[model samples]
Target: MRKPLQHIWALPVLAAGLAVPATAPAQSIDVTLVNGHPSIFLWVKHLTETFIPAVNTALEGTDYAINWSEAYGGSLAAVGGELEAVEVGLAEVAAIPTVFMPTQLPLQNVSYNTPFGPSDPRLVMESVAMLHDTVPGVEESWHEYDAEYLGGGFALDNYVLMTNFPVTSIEDLEGRRIAAPGPAVNWLEGTGAVGVSGNLTTYYNDIQTGVFDGVIVFPTAAAPARLHEVAPYVTITDFGAQYAGTLVANRTWFADQPEAVQNALRDAAAAYTEAYLVEQTDRVAAAMATIASDDDHLHVLAPEERTRWASALPDIAGVWAENANGMGLPGSEVLTAYIDALKAAGADLGRDWSQR
Candidate 1:
């Protein structure tokens, strides 16, 4: 039988917060954690290396124990299928990519709707958590799907462009076919490049097979994929850090767990958020360095060139907000709050979506 992971990310302090009752009966609860992307993905790695160990540490000496089973790399669910997996009770906990659930989680796509705003992954996710508190319909959407969100979120570092061809300006991308995941596809507007919907799993093969010429992705993931070998041109796009996904527990399962177990999971989830971001932030530079070398040359698109690209894009933010409003969500409110918070954090936004 598979056992709970024993890992270095364990925190002894996590035990203090768990309520261990002396009279409680010992029980081992089975939990299966699912991530569509495999452990090679930075977020999934942290969920395994940091989140799971902390969860074990939190439950030490408690009346409840968790027997963890993992299903990753689409063993149980594919990218964009995580929400349904938890809702159907196929898994107890999961790392859900919100970008793939735009129709169901429109409010969670605030950062995707307003791009080029913030570059700090930590700030982006913290702002999203704040939205969960201040925004009325945010968490409610998750509840509607029978999932309870834990704070362990996967936020992307600034997105860069990897292409088979060199790009010194936005115009160079004209007529090129580029792959982007989910809402990121919308970012290609007015760049004259065709945006193909895709995820990390298929990027390398797809690019090599002529499915696309390039991909817009972050360094942490790009390095692991070894995208440089296939598409050697790396351009720093500065599209900014984005909150792509988060950890969630099946609502019914999470509620049914013992309070002590629940507390531990929740605390560990928060720890997952911190640990994931810390590692991700650190990995970004190293990943970039690894992906860029003499053979795989790195280019920084001129500041004015990026600004030109940003300006040419349509009002995706307004359109997204209006669509949300059509669905009775507070689109304007969420957008305003997110942008305002980023500004307050000293992010030199390239464009204020709330304005235009």
Candidate 2:
């Protein structure tokens, strides 16, 4: 559990007026927070509830304040357009999905391709931190875009399969119209599944109207949309977590912040990440249970069937690296560093794509 906001508030206030006040004068920095996801998604919920409040806790005594302007559901920036929005100063802070901007930030997508590498969210989070620390130009990837990478939010985990029709095996998925989010379509390639591009906002309607047999979505979005009611077959492919989402601020604005405010923002980002991770884990279970209780609709793929699907999917790592290289980024090197870190953390060879 997180410490109360009141407790966090007391730190700066207690030191004020002292001979050498416990902390320096509080510094405040104003930033406009933005996101491409809808208001109902877990990522958005985390942004509003856990993130905003946590930052406020960090700034308890600081004069630096976050001017939170939530331009959600792509109101400020369309899906796959956050990079331009930040680079052009339309937004001061953004929670951009690295997958959405693969060409611009290829290094971050390494995790998305390495499926089933690790299920522990804590280890996964640490792997990302380690990769950023060890990889060259990794942090600098953001500099060119005029944004500073604050940190990563929770990995929503490899997507689960939610279908209006039950799909129990790779054979079952053949020729079915599947709704996949951007870049994720690569995973469905060669599965004989017909892929359609769609975002979470349109998922419920699409499924209800039979636009798709099912969609690959995170539990966070599925539960809120009551997708379980429509397409209850939740198949946990566990394809590994995508680099998921990022919490970042405009580099120009971040650079001008007082040290205290910067520290506060950092602290808040970490707090928000941890809390959101826990929340997502809970949502997965709750969503699963709800669908299961509905009986006829909900189904989980058997273990052997899951293995078959995993085997059939393309080796996304090679595709990702090649794509990044084509974009003139250090695609192969960053991928190497990510794989090495996961192995060092005790990841098994079968799940390590670097060696492959």
Candidate 3:
């Protein structure tokens, strides 16, 4: 009877020991990503292809897993509504295009205000990332909107002019109407080209309807839009690649996340940046080739002509810095740091925006 009782106790103890090795299921965290534009765009595409997958992989074997919800193509917000969407907690993270939110993110628009710099997307992203990491004002600009900047992503290739007619010199653009997106209207300054505010979605129809004679755009985008069909002449103005926006997360939600989860989001952002640059760089040449093959009229503006176009522009950078300073943001400091970093990186700048 004593042996039987001991065996019964040992059986219960063995059962308890077996249960201890059964680990609890990982916690599931819900994260929603939003973008104003459709996922067809390269940056948005990477969110699904590169960034999200990277995050999932990083979180593997961890105690937490993310269940992602994606809102893109104006499903959650329009072209310029991403910043506000994230701020109000409509989404956990977003790709906020700084060009569209000039009033709210003036400091992040450093690349847009100062153009004709490096054409390489990789170099442009590096310079902007360095500023975000080093410049307190740059990061603070995002904080003001209740979000945190992760990393920068740039569109492919340098900006160019797509026109119905040929442009041999700066004088050619004089008195002609040109459609430029948002602040890019500044690029047409002093060129005599009448700058009309426009975007990619409307570029083709606008030019076809005679609303604007030409458009300032990059190859990767222009080719897909088939702008060459209406505006056959493409002048490589070398306006330089631009750091359009970044991956950002809502401040409140990001703060509440576990440390491991936070690291995964950031690490994934870094990977997204690298993957985007690689694709953007490769796509440039291919896009240019497709355009050249499709359109008979293609011109690479003379080096001297390019220089004149850049030099004739007014001190827009100075005006931008002044405006930012008035808003109590460190515009001048960031501008100086950005130009210096680009120079140190061996960027072939057409103008030293900071010096001016």
The top-ranked prediction according to TM-score is 3
CA lDDT, candidate 3, residue 257: 91
lDDT of each: 0.88, 0.74, 0.86
lDDT, candidate 1, 1-356, per-residue tens: 65456633354445644665346666889999998998998889988898899989988888778899999999999999999999999999999999888889998888988878678898999999999888888878799889998865878999989999999888898999999988889999988899999999999999999999999998999999999889999998789889899889999989888888888888988998898888887888789888887644889877787788888889999999999999989998899999989989999677888887
lDDT (10s digit) by residue, model 3, range 1-356: 35787788899899999988978888999888998877767889899999999999999999999899999988999888999999999999898877777788888788888989899888878888888889887887888889987776554468888899988789998799999877889999999999988777788898999999999998888877888888888888889988788899999899999999899999999999888888887788887876556445788888888888888999989999999999999999989998998888899888889876
Misplaced by over 4 Å in model 1 are 1-25
Give the Å error, residue 141, model 3.
1.1
Model 2: per-residue Cα lDDT over 143-244, one tens digit each? 998988887566765467888777666777789999877667766877889988787778888888888898987665677788887887777666555567
Residue 43 in candidate 2, Cα distance off native in Å: 2.1
Off by over 4 Å in 3: 1-21
Error of 2 at 144 (Å): 1.9
lDDT of 2 at 204: 85
Better of 1 and 3 by lDDT: 1
Error of 3 at 151 (Å): 2.5
